[model samples]
Target chain A: MDISPDESIFLHIGPVALNATIVYTWITMAVILAISWLGTRKLTSESKMSRWQNLLEVLILGMKNQIRSISHQEPDKFLPFIGTLFLFIAVSIIMSIIPVYQPPTGSLSTTAALAICVFVAVPVYGIAKHGIIGYLKYYLKPTPFMLPFNVLGEISRTIALAVRLFGNVMSGSIIVAILLSIAPLFFPILMQALGLLTGLIQAYIFAILSVVYIASATRVHEEKEQKFEENRKGKE
Target chain B: MLINWFTVFAQIFNFLLLVFLLKHFLYGRIISAMNVREEKIASRLQEAEQKMMDAEHERDLYFQKNKENDERCAGLFASANLEAEAQKKELIENARRQVDEMKKRWNESLREERDVFLSNLRKRAEKQIYIILGKIFSDLSNTKLEQNIVETFLGKIKSLDHTERNHIKVILKESYNKAVISSTYEIPVEQQHIITAEIGDAVGETVEIRYINSQDHICGIEFKVKNYRIGWNVDDYVKFLEREVNKTLEEELAG
Candidate 1:
């Protein structure tokens, strides 16, 4: 059995191969976009809301609140990135229970791509808030000699993010496949349920970690500004 | 390694695309709708607060107006009470005044009526006394009484001063020496002749005498010589008694 969806390639064109992971990623994206369109097409601004709209609001608001609480910043600026990451991962994991579907998150490629986005977004947000020079100055904090370690830590944490999510999702699928070969029915269903749980957990972890990284980058500048304000007030 | 570099890049692009799509379709609409609902609630709350203030102001104004009305009503009621009391007093005073005036008028009318009644009774008594005196004088009237009256009158004429005797003579001469004798009753011819002779001797002139019976003399005799008159009778004594009685009654009323 293939360990990940990437191993199952249905088509090949030069170096660009259409694999199960890519196909499933597209399917997940399509389903998310379609549902988003349908859910938001008839939005009412009044206090009263339909059940489906209420559910969507609760989910969206919960995620935004979580992001805001962790980051100590406005959630709107990072909601699209953070929300997309969570939805894509969670949708992939939920769709895995279907017999005809393979989860895209079980692939190393998708996890690495999500991790890279977070990694790239961290620097972008930091640069946007503190400027490039101010953001780079954090690496030289405490001493200039700790720069390489801070850089390595950044790279290692990104790698850890990608590897951790990929490993958890792939192992769940692999364990379910092994369980299906031995007992085919009840155990596989149980393992799949457990896998769904693990998948949801992994999605949460990934979204939280990304929010932490973004917040870490921006928090230092915010603190500096706060301290400067306090010092100005003290002088006054 | 299950890593595919191309797939990784493709997935990154796909993830960015999904972020863009969801931001456009879902988060934006939801946030905007929530913001709109919040705005409506805030505006409604502000409107409610304004209305509450307006209601409170109106209530205060109404309370003030009610207080003023109550005060005005109380003032009006007090004034009305005072005016009513004053009017009642005035009415009582006027009634008392009218009653006093009526009493005064009634007393005056009663006094006037009593005075008139007393005056009428006194007049009747005087009339009765006059009738009794007339009857006594008539009973007492005789030739001797007349002769004594004539002699007393002649003595009074002899006692007269010369100027009065001359005035009587001049009056007698103006009337061609004619004189009239008036009496309430008929006198005897002899008495008349004697009165005339004594008057001539006293006056030193002989006067022609005419005798007239006059009931108004009330048993008195009057001798008229032109506008001059002289005589004596029982009527003089009766008149003196009547004057004494009227004077005594006047003294009693004064006392």
Candidate 2:
């Protein structure tokens, strides 16, 4: 049995190949896109709305609130990246309920790609707030001697983020597969149910962690701005 | 083996694309709609507050107007009451004056009516006395009323006192010795001579007696010399009776 959807190659064009990972990722993307289009095609600011619109609003507002609480700032900036991470992970994991469906999140490459996106986004947002010179200066905090360790810490945490998500999602699928072979009926269903819960929890954890990282990177600029305002007031 | 390089890159592209698409479709539209609804609610609240303020101002204005109207009404009512009181007093005074004028006119009319009654009484008394005396002379004495009248005139002249004789004498002298002897009827020659001789003896002068027939003597004789007069007539007796009657009536009214 393939442990990752990446192993199930569907086509090959010399060095390039199509696999279950890419195919299921496209499917997940398609599902997300279709639902988003349907929900927002006739968006209204009025009080009355369709159930689908309400559901979508609830979802988007919930993510924004979550991001706002973690970042302690406006959620609008971080919402797109963090919200996509949660929805993609959760939906990919939930799709595993269908027979013969391989969750794209169960693939190590997919999780790594998501983690790399978070890793890249942290500095991007930080640089957007404080400029590249100001953002890079955070690594040299406490002392220049600790800069290498801070850089290492950043690399290690990105690897941990990727590995942690992959391990959790892959282990759940593997356990359900092993249980299907051993008991096949009640235990596999129970494991699948447990997997659904863990899948949602993992998505939450991943989104929250990304927000924390991004917030940490951008928080220095906010502190500087606050201190500047205080100094200006003191002068006044 | 687990981490495919191509797939990882492909997934990264997919995730970024998804973010871009979701931002365009969902987050941007939803946030904008929420903001618009919030702004609309805020503006509506402001409008409602303004309307409430306007209503309160109108209420205050109405209250002020009502107060002014009440004051004006009270002032008008007080002035009207004063005017009405003044008019009432003036009406009462005019009524009293009219009543006094009417009372005075009534008294004047009563006095005029009393005068007319007294005059009529005097005339009637005179006529009645004359008629009664004529009847008494014819019934009792078997003599003419003219003879009795002439005898009475002669007797009055003969009984004159010394001072009354001197007065008649002076009057006769001033009258060119012409005396007018008027009677209600013509006297007989004998009675006339007796009257002339008695007057001449009393005065100690020959008076030129002019006998006049007149109705003014009231059935008696009147001897007049210019403004001076001496006579015996029913008029004297009637005047004395009228004076006594008037005195009695005054006493009765006083009582």
Candidate 3:
């Protein structure tokens, strides 16, 4: 009773000592892969959905609907990348129930990497739809002098999105681990529920914020570019 | 904070693979099969409608042809009836002509037979009369005297008038009394000699004797200035007509 099962976890990486969290991470990955395979294989449009398909469909729909509602633009293209991000974060956060389980989203590396992916994808899609010169016109809106502040604001929002998910998920993991170490059993349930709820909230926030960023970047510029291209064709 | 990049990367990659698999296998096959079945049903319905239209067109052609044939048959029937009626009329007319020709031929033969029979009868009557007249007139040849009158009263003229009506009647009456009538029933020899001189004597009047079928019969007048009347009776003519008709009928029936 003196030594806890939670502390016994350690990793032997050729000479370095690492915690047992790696095992839990590997197990979570296996769970996600198995679920994805089965869910995809069993997918039926008319039949009842599996838990994995339901989760995926819901997360994708939420992102799409929110993006469409905000910008009134087609949002289905943004869904896959956003849905992947949501699924990764959700699985990571839900694994916090294990004593050594900590979400990858807690690390600045993981959240920033995802944020950067969303960050780069938005501009890439925008430039693909609208030319470089046309995309720049979006920043010139309200005034050309407002470009510096607008660029700063956009970079800051990307940073905020990353940090916010990492903080929330990491905080929930730390709180659960500390509480479980102290009370051990009955009290851990309370921490687990809190961690689960917080994990879901963090996932939703990350997905929606990323969709908003991408939607803002790509939405209006593409419209004006279409009209411009049409006019150029007419002039020709 | 714990970071498990391996798990995070694995899960994302797995989800992407699943989406691709579903797009290729499951949804693709179901949608394609549904479209093919729908196209088959539509084509079958179209074929059935086309067949129905073709059948209706064929039926109309058949019905139209049948109507034409019926009309042609009616025309043929009417033509046949008219042809039959024409042939019947021609046959009736031919029968009438034949009957008329037969009646004409029969009348001709009847007249010829009557002439032959009447000539025989006249010869026989002549023979009988010659015998009777010879007995009565043999002694009176030199005397040649006779007179007769229908009216009992006579008037004599002071001078001779040859154009008097009474004198013609008196001459005709004297010839009749001498040759045809007498108190001793004697025929005058002079009247006989006069009758022999003329074939059908004219003595101011003519006498007609009708036979059954002959155009004329013998009529003679013998008188010094008038002639006696001589003609066959209606009863004798009727009997002669019946005898000749019966003879022709018997010959035709025998032949």
- Candidate 1 residue B41 C-alpha distance from true site, Å: 1.6
Question: Candidate 1 lDDT, tens digit per residue, B106-190?
Answer: 8778667756766665556556655776566567875354455556666776787889889998988888998888876677888
What lDDT would each prediction earn against the true structure? 0.85, 0.88, 0.57
Model 1 reaches what TM-score against the true structure? 0.67
Tell how far residue A158 is off in model 3, in angstroms. 1.0
- Candidate 3 residue runs with Cα over 4 Å from true position: A1-27, A42-71, A223-236, B1-255
All models, DockQ values?
A: 0.67, 0.70, 0.05
- Interface RMS for model 1: 0.8
Q: Give TM-scores for every candidate, taking all chains together and pairing residue i with residue i.
A: 0.67, 0.70, 0.43
**lDDT tens digits by residue: candidate 1, A139-177:** 887579999999999999999999999999999988988
Q: Rank the candidates by TM-score, best first.
A: 2, 1, 3
Which residue segments of model 1 deviate by more than 4 Å? Answer: A13-15, A224-236, B95-255
Clash pairs, candidate 3, are none
Of the pair 1 and 3, which is ahead by lDDT?
1
Give candidate 3's TM-score.
0.43
Candidates sorted by DockQ, descending order? Answer: 2, 1, 3
